[model samples]
Target chain A: MADASSTAKYEALHNGIEPPSFKLPLIDNPEIVTANTLKLVEQTPDARKRFLFTTLTRYLHDFIKETKPTTEEWHGTLKFLSRAGQLSTPDRQEMELILDIFGAEALIDTINNPPKDSVTERALLGPFFTEHTHDVSNGDSIASEGKGEYMYVDGRVVDTEGKPIANAVVDAWEADDTGHYDLQYDNGVPDCRGRLRTDAEGKFNFRAIVPIAYPLLSDGPLGELLLAMNRHNMRPSHLHIIVDAPGYEKLVTQFYPSEDKWIDSDSVLGVKKSLVVDLEQVNDVESAKALGFQHPERGFKLFKRDIVMRRKVDA
Target chain B: MADASSTAKYEALHNGIEPPSFKLPLIDNPEIVTANTLKLVEQTPDARKRFLFTTLTRYLHDFIKETKPTTEEWHGTLKFLSRAGQLSTPDRQEMELILDIFGAEALIDTINNPPKDSVTERALLGPFFTEHTHDVSNGDSIASEGKGEYMYVDGRVVDTEGKPIANAVVDAWEADDTGHYDLQYDNGVPDCRGRLRTDAEGKFNFRAIVPIAYPLLSDGPLGELLLAMNRHNMRPSHLHIIVDAPGYEKLVTQFYPSEDKWIDSDSVLGVKKSLVVDLEQVNDVESAKALGFQHPERGFKLFKRDIVMRRKVDA
Candidate 1:
């Protein structure tokens, strides 16, 4: 058992800050409480910190006043938040998933990376993205044979002015036909994910399996919240890609297949009309053969899109 | 080491809920994201829950839009919250402490339990309260000898109209003069805290140590937050008490000594004007002897107040 007095040591140390010079009236009412809190927050020396906390306090207090949650409900909310944190792991980002499901992540992403004409809109950097992807050469397959049906993804990285940007690093990841990422399996190896640098013409192509729609974790607090809200926890099938090049704003985006059933109601609110693309089924065996598919006779689905990035100065 | 595949098991289980029939417009912008989230929240069958979540979504989104915290700041927030939960134990409620320091708890309490005429206002039931406490008779000392300077507390539990409430239970607890609760010590036994019943005349009196002003735990995320906000972490000296009786609302509150230097600026925003009381110094040896102090010559501080409880119907 843990020692009960473990927290006692913290009680002895002070933050070394003295009381505020201004006198606060007794917090006899709710308004006084808010006023006093804001007054104290104003003491922050950093302008950005002060503004962020002041705004947060105002919105939080407004939420409490408008919702008027009972004591039990408030306690339950706190318990749920704590459980979300406790369930989070390096691979399983339960807290971020909560923010995603609640649409907060989407909102923040949208605000920070606002849309620019001719520049690809940013999307949520989901919990599945990993830096340990295998490096593959052009026209190489990101997935091993038999992972799923054949799919060829090709795209060109270019500036908003339509100039190709050569040697741009592209990282792509997606769930397999089983609706699970490579990291979800016990094999402890990166699969159905790869990193490749664009050729001299800013062109890149990778052979992969067809991505499948999947559900977020349904056993944790996020699942419970979705259930309570009477919403499905399924995300539309999409391929996540991040492109980076010097002297340009990094582009983080996703390509969603328009035909997916959950395309409109992505649980994370990550979908955009501009990002959705149609996959063409090409039955030509020669086309699959040229793409290095093991079963050329089965043909392959072709996905082609050109990514537009903005310069860092423009951003 | 924990198995990496432990979370994979949860991935296979879906929430068993179908997508809503309504078509959410493509979430191409921040406005659409917030609109879709509120729409989804409206699907909740429970009226109260729907209202609460809808309000919460609005304020949360508004906060995000107003503050526009950078991606790094947002991630930092999630990490801080997760650390708070990880550090919390059965005895240490780091999550609630976060809410307290942020002033959310005070606002919730104020809104949910609005004050009524002739009734004592409630205060925060701080994290130090425990279920296990010693049962002491009236007029007996709650603290052991040498705990602190002698103090005699006398109070009556009465109705709003001043009628006596016989057999009412009064639970009293406080930190010692050294600014620590019994639970804060490693002894693992209750001290400086007790539960007692009122007499037929609705009178209750107890002997205890003089409560001392103290700083809150300053080694956790809460401390970091206070330091960042440029605020102190001190709570004024106060005795915690809970009075319960038949056909009346249970009162959870604290009595702050008016003379304490920190009385006006409670770190948790718990102090109220009506809850403040003055401790009368009694120097007469006979008075101290009658109150059962070990050294009558040293005398004792006297705290006397009558608690007015609102009836259940009135509340």
Candidate 2:
């Protein structure tokens, strides 16, 4: 009855009824079977699935060929997108974070950026990459909150030929006294994160804040995927680094603190054997002062290291 | 400065802050990495995909454990989910459609739904399951509107045992003169959709409609994925059916109207050789009336079919 009335009304309005505006556009295409799906051609794997994927893939292309978004749906998509920007902070690059968690970040970088020839593996741009580093001296403390371990770290940046790459920027940052990134400190002291440029001889050093293993944020769709995997989210002690040179491919990598247990199990597959370094203690005051420490007698740990990179042209 | 003020306020008003309130419970029995993931493990033809599947499954678990959502985020997720339901229609099961395009629906139905012993392959629940079909004589006409070839289709539904399955329902619906489903016929006249029950002797008949080939909806995320995969979305001429019996598993299948130009290339991979039936014309009236048609010379076609099903225990 409703159909009949609606038909009559439509006829009265327009000389003839027309298709509802929502119908999909017409398309014609062929199906291609791939090695990945050939075995499921019959029996156990279920042939319908193979056919469905093959057919649906074509349908999807046609849809894209004729993309149509309603004004309201388009606006809703835009509005939802705006919230992603609002959610970002120094400790929270929610947009990039979302991409990372969903695997798109890894996929795009892997496909388009393939670790430039011989540069150190490029890690993800995590939420904590701020512009400046606190200028702590050779033995100055970074654990101002007075919590966590009290160890030291040191390293150098170099090129493929093992020569020290002078003046390379070796910015570093990490969670602080309470295992929370500076921006997440929410309490205002962005003291836990910092950066440092390597010296003329390609050496860089810092003191205070022995790093401890900590878990990733335990919330959101990403968190849910991780928990379902039964894997631990703890990251081993590590120092973030961004090495850049005018004519060399830049490298963003991390040095895992040797004692932290999760180095071998970094969830994002960020840890590498060459990126692990040891922090040894030195009780010599004169030696500390030579390294620019005000407290010569103050105990300090030392990290000595070098990094290699491929020439930019080759990369 | 703001940090200092907030610190002072915190000390004066609430003493030192306690630990953060958002701690996630860690697992006591963490899963041991029993096997190296980089090596060949599953020997199946799709070993690579299988490995990826397992790896992602585990990773998702871990992600969930670490990212426990705050109450607000949880509520936001709920609200986001409600939109999926609001988007559904009789012609389109949005959620099921998503599941189909994502392979989740087939995976769930194929691997999870049926008992281990069934021989019939489980297929996906398509978007066009809404239209109600009706009973029409073999020589009857179904051309209410739109355009296509004038075809007279005849076929039988049989079980593995080859016995007739009496009174099985053969509900059918398809596109009219235009390549659109009844749901897409929002303008008027619920034309090309109907339901028809078979006679006690496993015989059923219908007339009038000869459907044109059509394209599936190609807009949305599913469409985008298809574009990335490079495929099209066209279904060949076919009759939809839902064959049911008291003790047998319900069969929702389609029979191709023999000779679709692209029968071999249905994007959805739904063309089965066994399901194709030829359409014949009957110019004689006595033979048409013997089969119970009111007219003969007026140019009607005769179609005879039997439906068969497997016995309860065997089925």
Candidate 3:
């Protein structure tokens, strides 16, 4: 009865017995598909999500129309996506790396959290971030046995006005001298990784070896894709850091060594000019004595950097 | 020494003592990233793949810029994609369905293979396609055990000129009365699925239960998405068919019951005007007996549709 009534309504409208309602007619094939897709997205009560799906559908359709990938290419893309999902783990984020490779991650971050003002530039959190970093007192060594060349890192947490922010939690991690991260090795405890809190004066310090530049993990489909695309897989030596303090926004970033060979060729494309720190090399004996190192005769480089934080929950 | 020499060359250029070499200036950040990405793809000797990746990066970046999805929204999309990939199995093509949902698959197919020249309209193979179908003799029933209302189908494979194409292989599949596809249940073997070859006159016949209108597998994220979007998940009653001949292009398509309530609202957007068949009910006992049905008085619907094929390898 309902179908008949609707049919009659359409017939009446066609025969000029009734006015045609102002409704979109389902005609064009692609348009019909878009209408159907949007029909589902329209039900989203969350305004943000609704907008996101709308844009996703539009751009996805646009991409397909523009690319016109063959059936085989389409199927192969699906297969590659499946492999990427399967390659991910709790510790390894293959899909995240894919986003970095595509430059979406950095672009999205820039969109959501624009970098300006006096705050430290936010870089990629990357796939290897593990909060398992054990906190130590200031000037403590995060370097596990047999890591990179000894390096001293002294930094301060501050507001836009450069006011020292005391008690900020500074977590840090980096790959070893061989360019392999701690998780890449058999040892459960992370090597060349540690955390420390800001002192009353807002200054914090930790000792670790210099990070080594290395290539990304290319054994998976992403790696194979990069290789096929003729892109380098290397990242410059850097230290990942996350700073958290009450009443301030969380800061996730990394600082690169200015002298690293791959500094200009970082594979993940997460580099920023301000984030690169110039290491100051000091005499071995003088440096060890000043920093109270057990091996006073063995000198290490020093890096000093200051970080600024936004207010908590700042958009 | 190499670094020193390069620095000296730059210094000489800066001092106006040497001509600057023709080099790609890395100005734009995103462009630099793209250039680096292209650098790797350039290593591939395969020209087609190189072209594909080049377009992929362009469109991907364009999408990000146009949509400006928030960090959370981007992450959510990645999660949804990962789930879609993980949800797939040998019998189910979840990603393919996702493509259909986004209308990319249909749009791409249309763009690549335009509909014209009397060729059969293409339809999605859908996740339920099974090559496990048994080859049956002509006029044999494909309905297994107890199922939906019985129907007789006779079809002919012909060229655009209407001449019969003998020995053409006809494959057919559909869901049962309960709206459950063969792959959806525990049945090791499928019902309502079979293939036959054209006779001397290019005619083929089969008996099967009428497929009922059914919703797609909405237990997955796709279902949740549709429900959220306030769209019906149902697809109209249809029969999936594939016709193949030695010198003809393989045709994968479906015929929709014109009377089906959801015929015009197929969730997959796969229905076409030429593919809708009007099933004719025949209570004629004499005709049933002629068709070799044991119970002639128990009437059955009859459908006769002809399929036209294009030459194999035609562009």
Candidate 4:
């Protein structure tokens, strides 16, 4: 049996701030409600926050007025948000997933990291990227044997002027043939993901499985949202890569295989025309043996491209 | 130790919807991303959802473009929403609280339930209403003794033409002197609330404690939001009531006492000018004795108001 004091703990407590000295008209109508809200928002101490909140309030109010969502519809939106939050865990960011599918994450990325004509275009730093990567020498396999069909990725890190950037660190990861990242598996060891550095000629290479198109998590609200919108949830097959050097702007990007079916509608809206590349089929036994494939007779797909980086000062 | 099959459960699963047949241009720029999103939203099967989502997407995109929040700022917003969701429980609706403070809920109510020229205006149906209420006869006490200073309330339910409505059900509830709902306490029994039917003359009376202005829940993200905006979280003291009868539009409302200090700046934006009323002091001993007070000489505050409900046809 709990006492009154036990329930008293949930009672309202003042936040210590006093009411505003300015007069607020009684909020009898929707317009007055919006007016009073904006006035209160003016009290925000930080200028940036004040501006952001004001803009948000105005736009959100305008949306409500224009759409006139019924009480039921508005409640639906709130419930959707709550369910998304409940489904999210540290390893699975359901909120970011929602933003991604809505193209909000892409918009934010575009606004914050606008393109430089000569530098490699940016893409979403998706939720799958991890710092716990295996360090492999150039040409070593990132995936262990029998993971998937073999693929070789070799690229050169160059400046905007096409000068080789020696010793630039390169990081790469991809989904295996089953369309799942290494982190999705119970095995703790990293696979189909690795880190390597460019050699003297700014050349870097790694052995990995051919990346496969993957679906966004469809067992949650996000999937239901996609179903409601009548849209698919597949991202095109792509290889994730990051190039970093001290004096240069870090390039976070992905190379979508041109032949993949879902290239144009990449679910997260992460596909850029310039970032799409072709993977050439190489069946030469000599080439396979030289690249350290355990089975030289079995040919592999080859992807070759050059990464152009801009100077940090230019960025 | 978890096996590979156990970990596989978290892998992405498709929602079974095929990709749309329409061509989506490569989403290399922000404008293209918005264009593609709007196109995809056109596929919604429901007309209302289509309009609402389309309007929401446009406004949301415009807001993003206008504010151009940096990556950190956008992430902060997402984190704030996530925390609000995580903190919410069945007992406390933090999301609705956020909506209330932001004036979204008020705006929605106003839009959905417009006021009639001659009828009583509607107010927010706050999160505190419960179906479990004690049945009290007219002129009986609703609150247990010692909850707060005594108050007497009598009201009549009438039509738009000012005719008495017999047997109209009137439901009333309020916070105790401590500014806490009976449900907020761990004690399972209900207090400071009741349900009663109007007499043949449409008149109903009951005794309750003097409702106190209460603060919204603090010690959570909502509290932090208020502090950041330099705003207080208090709602003006008021009594919640609902009047319902066959053929009459249900009237959900609250009467704000003009003497409460927080009347002008209700944190929930729930106050309206017409709903404010004066609580007259009645110091007559005869009235206290007639009202069945244990200490007849103490006297009590008096509140009198007539509720006018619109017909369902008019509504």
Highest DockQ against the true fold, candidate: 4
The local lDDT score (0 to 100) that residue A218 gets in candidate 4 is 81
Order candidates by TM-score, high to low: 4, 1, 3, 2
1 or 3, greater by DockQ: 1
Error of 3 at A252 (Å): 2.4
TM-score for each candidate, following the candidate numbering? 0.92, 0.60, 0.84, 0.94
Q: What is the lDDT of residue B79 in candidate 2?
A: 37
**Better lDDT candidate (1, 2):** 1
Superposition error at B180 for model 3 (Å): 2.4
Residue B127 CA error for candidate 2 (Å)?
A: 1.5
State the displacement of the C-alpha of residue B263, model 3, in Å, after optimal TM-score superposition: 2.2
True contacts kept of each: 0.70, 0.01, 0.26, 0.74
- The weakest ten consecutive residues by lDDT in model 2 chain A span A9-18
Better of 2 and 4 by DockQ: 4
lDDT of 2 at B39: 17
- Which 10 consecutive residues of model 1 chain A have the lowest summed lDDT? A1-10
- Which pairs, if any, clash in model 3? A40-B229, A229-B40, A229-B41, A230-B40, A230-B41, A231-B40, A284-A299
In model 4, pairs of residues that clash are none
Off by over 4 Å in 4: A1-9, A294-298, A313-315, B1-9, B294-298, B313-315
